[model samples]
Target: MVHPIKVQLNDLMVKREEFEADVSLRSERLDAAGVGLHGSLLDKEGYPRADIDIMSIRTDRKRIAELTNDHKSVTNQIEKLIQELHAATKDSKPSHDRPSAPAASTTDKPPEQSNGIAAPVPAGRPVHAAQYSRPLAVVDGVSEASPASRAGIQVGDALVSLGGASWESGTISLQQIAAAVQASEGKEVPAIVLRQGETVSLKLTPERWAGQGLLGCHLRPIGDTTRG
Candidate 1:
């Protein structure tokens, strides 16, 4: 079944593409008029440049400026939508299902230092949980009978956090994810994702399977998605 979040995402993608196409049209119009986007409208003596169609370029420039501003507004709207989607997802989940950050320990014992001092837990997810788990990567492909598949991570899901490698300060790299999985080895590592707009937390134990990668999934940078 098509997830509502995925449906909304598809609609947004189509809208962004239309915006891109509109911007492209304006660019093409400028090119055809033999004028640069920021080319001086006036000649050396502060007179209007007669070589190019100044009047037409001026009109195009105004439209381009308007479109640019509108595009930013659209982008902000998209950001807000994603935030709300994730927030709703988190809120909707049961308390027991709410996954903890990397700082959390799954053991029965309290997490502590060698001297038995209680370890400090970061107030919240270092990456800012309020970001609604901004996606680190998109699951492009998932092998059947693989750990990722077993964990319920589907191919169109957006990976928000995996094990100890969620993003913070800057973007999280694929290598970091690999390292986190490798370190976990046979242990159960928490996996968080947005599947069809619903936040689903999973446990993925990276062990030997008849698959190629640790999770048997392809993760590409955010926005470079294959599935709608």
Candidate 2:
């Protein structure tokens, strides 16, 4: 027949097993954090960026309670073992040679910034050419030191020709001609433009400029009302 002490030990062992099972279940839940949930914001690559919601905290609280209860039960079992050892070593000094526990880790993340608003670009593409080829609606704040400004191009000038080579009106852009001019050696290039409803000509030369292509002028499209 099984002794009474043996039955009592078996019951304690079952309780320990149950505590271990609870720990394992809690670990599994933590590993599957935020499963199948939509995030509050999208990141630069258009993937969902997880945000901490109060509901997620509530979920974590339940797991933490389970973990705490399991830990308390295990600690009680350890205390019982310590008491038994104390009795056995009554004549001896308690060993102070136990390994120190490691410090728990914490990661305090900084607050996230909002990326929901899409800011509009002023023009379709930024900064167009003033060389006589393409015309863009002249907006206010067009630079005065650009090539367009030096060539008698006003804020209301429409491009017509460059070095006598004509382009389809409004089909060419300022950037393409500027790029070509950037690639060229210093020379006086003939240009034609329509300003205030009159066609005019100018010869322009690029200096070995310090900054990215500076012309000594500013201009705007002829029909643009935004120009000051």
TM-score of each: 0.46, 0.31
Q: Write the per-residue lDDT of candidate 1 for residues 31-128, one digit (tens) a residue.
A: 87767588787878999887888888888888878878876776555555655666666688887776654443344222355755333223222332
Question: Residue 193 error for model 1, in Å?
Answer: 6.1
TM-score of 1: 0.46
Clashes of 1: 0
What residue runs in model 1 are displaced by over 4 Å at the alpha carbon? 1-9, 94-228
Error of 1 at 47 (Å): 3.2
Q: How many clashes does each candidate structure show, in the order listed?
A: 0, 12
Worst 10 residues of 2 by lDDT: 118-127
Q: Candidate 2 clash total? A: 12
* Local accuracy by lDDT, each model: 0.65, 0.43
- Report how far residue 42 has shifted in candidate 2, in Å: 16
Can you write out model 2's per-residue Cα lDDT over 40-124, one digit (the tens) per residue?
3355787655553436545655665776787567545543543343344343434554223333333211112264221211211
